[model samples]
Target: MSDLVSIPADAPTQGMEPNGWIVVGVPTNFFATASAHARSGPLLGAAAEVRFTPVGFRWDYGDGTSRTSASGGASWAALNLPEFSETSTSHVFEQPGTVSIGLVASYAAEYRFAGGEWRAVQGLVLVPTTPIIAIADRADTVLVAESCSINPSGPGC
Candidate 1:
């Protein structure tokens, strides 16, 4: 019966607060965008439609750390929070390195056949989003004679 309906494996899109690079020991905000969609096909030898809706999200920070959230999370701008502010989907990198961060979206489905009432599909569909390659670096405070741009060759510059 489950084989009659098809759900899309299309992955979600992810965004980072800093746009690409993150800093160690600081919250790096993450967000995902997904939408409910329906597909039409044949089920039980009758015309049918299946709808998929996102219900949960799993975040894999790729540093041996992972978390699951009921919400996919929103951008800092969307949430009206300052950049680098802690969010439900934010994570703190403990060290400096290049890491692959990823998200897996879980979807609940409903199907209707021959214009009948919608029925639960009985299982969740898991789809992985495109991985984000982020470079985590440590921020250092240095006392220099002049700014790096102006000096170009001074102490820390």
Candidate 2:
């Protein structure tokens, strides 16, 4: 996915100056790609191109865990994949649950350039629920009784 990035203000501006205001801009256009897979199964890929400066970025795979990466050249890794980078991580859900994956990118930092210092841009990703099921069977008397209490409105019931 490609998004247009914009810089943020360090603090709220109260009044307009005589000549309005002066704003600083930073270099945009960054590209990042992420791929996830079961250690032995299929792989899923996602990519994003930064259109502006971002201070921080995080990824939540909706498996009860999350990962984060910096927008700059900094790198991060996961335990399952030792040789991996920050933009990607491998995860496995312990049980069946609705997984809503997403990303949070924000302008939480300031940088100093040749001219001066300026705040960065930010973005986020919102993923819907993804069901993951693990099969198991257990016998419970309450459940059995509830199942046996049929409404008798249909043949199966």
Candidate 3:
């Protein structure tokens, strides 16, 4: 089996927001289940640190709240020789709504032990899921067919 990791965006569920919050990182993806009961349960838990030079990252809470952070040419090899870890800054949402999260990490290209030159690695984006309101006054649901189009092209002709 492959190892899985979970990252939680530390946000408030109730009461007033606090300054400087820390997010819990888990080894598995538990945001979907945990966030559902975040109001009553622990929002931040144990989380694994992600290793790699992160150039930048962005988060979009479907509720119309978003945030972004970036880093410049930081050398990790000097500290530990080609390895580094970074924890994201904490953010809180005043209102409850769906949230879409994205992340991007970059690594400086390095020549292999054999031979090569320095290069740059492309960034990455991860969209976990749209956060759903566990408890809401009113809920709306919509359904649609998997493979259906409003305007047909050939068969009828």
Candidate 4:
């Protein structure tokens, strides 16, 4: 019965800034969730109905830096975290270039069957979720005479 569980597919959804490039040494936010991408019932070949929730994320920042985020960090602007202004899932890039970021999404699974109560699985399972995200980190060489917040169209702001 355990063998039937096999490996379930859970594609994570990614969310981040559209055009803003991450600045060197500046913390940038990345968002993702590791829930079932598609399903209405028990997974195929599984003995029971299993539901997976993101417990953590393993991040490869493409610069030899790796970190684990437990909460998948909210946006700093959203949560109002101070200083580096980061969510739990934020990363700091030290160089300027196009870096490929990889995520090994970890999930805690629970299973139940027809007329049975849900029970947590033994341990966490990790899977490489979706295409590797490429983040463009640029040098903060642009000189802004005015705050980018005040005038987004201003020169280099």
Candidate 5:
């Protein structure tokens, strides 16, 4: 499966607060699925084919933090919740700057071809993790005397 398919690049990365805003200790999300294929070869013996499916992910938050998750993180809207209210994979940062985040997708494959019974692979295989993506977070300090509900103009609310 490793040689046949690569991890999808549509990994989720968003919910980041912009400059002048300080939203900390919040949950963000990411999502990626697997691709399937079956081709002709001796490996198949013209009697079998293979399918690779993403089972989970190991994530690097790039701030000396990492975690493994069973399901891809979802968007706030996808969960029908307000912004910053829910998450599947999340991180907390002490200070802010550019952070390098990455994901190593694990796959569980099965073989079924020529109308034969499906057989599961013994274990999971991981994709190469050399390539990674980065995100920037900003830190700001603001002094405000009013609340967003009352003032709706307070800084950093």
Candidate 6:
């Protein structure tokens, strides 16, 4: 097969732990959500069906760092790990600022014409998800008389 597949696949979405405002020097988890999809189009004057299957995930931490993983990282609770624990797709920010986190899903494709047997495509389809912007900040530990939820204006609350 020629190393080409003109069909485009849907991009995956990115999910982050802590949602926003991550702590500096702490590991922040990231994950990707992707699924296989089928699309029908005209190929060489015949009806063709193309199916895309997600095979890889790539993460761009937007801090001059990136990583590729076979499986999308799961939540801390899902993984049974404590918060701030290191994960396969986690990234730690060294400074306090805003950064964009990005995810790209790579898909392998197969095609069939007129309900015939499926044929594997030679190359993968790369699709990028919308970047998620997050703020990185520092957190401090302070013992107080009451919890922050109880005392909104309390020190360090």
- lDDT tens per residue, model 6, 47-146: 7888889999988888898999988778878887756678988988999899988888988888898889989888787888889999998888746688
State the number of backbone clashes in model 6: 0
Best by lDDT: 1
Q: For residues 13-118, what per-residue lDDT tens digits would candidate 2 score against the true structure?
A: 1111111111111111112333221111111222222222344445454446665555322222212211211222323334443334455544332233333444
Q: Per-residue lDDT tens digits of candidate 1, residues 1-157?
A: 3663354545678898788898888899988987888888766676778888889899999899999998889998899775568899999999999999989999888888777899998879888877999999998764656787987654333
A best-first ranking of the candidates according to their TM-score comes to 1, 6, 4, 5, 3, 2
Q: What are the lDDT figures for the candidates, one per model?
A: 0.82, 0.29, 0.27, 0.64, 0.54, 0.81
Alpha-carbon shift of residue 29 in model 6 (angstroms): 0.4
Backbone clash pairs for candidate 3 read 25-46, 25-47, 26-47, 61-99, 62-98, 62-99, 77-82, 109-119
Q: How many pairs of residues in model 4 come into backbone collision?
A: 0
lDDT of 4: 0.64
TM-score of each: 0.82, 0.27, 0.28, 0.68, 0.62, 0.82
For candidate 1, the clash count comes to 0
lDDT (Cα, tens digit) per residue for candidate 4, span 1-157: 2432464747566655332456677677776765553223544444456667777878787788888877665554566543345466777887777777777888777777664787777777677855455556566476656787887645343
TM-score of model 1 (CA atoms): 0.82
Clashing pairs in 5: none
Model 6 misplacement above 4 A: 1-7, 142-157
> Measured by TM-score, how close is model 5 to the native structure?
0.62
Q: At residue 78, give the lDDT of candidate 3.
A: 25
RMSD of each: 6.2, 22.5, 20.9, 4.6, 5.6, 5.0
**Backbone atom clashes (below 3 Å) for every candidate:** 0, 1, 8, 0, 0, 0
- Which model, 1 or 4, shows the larger lDDT? 1
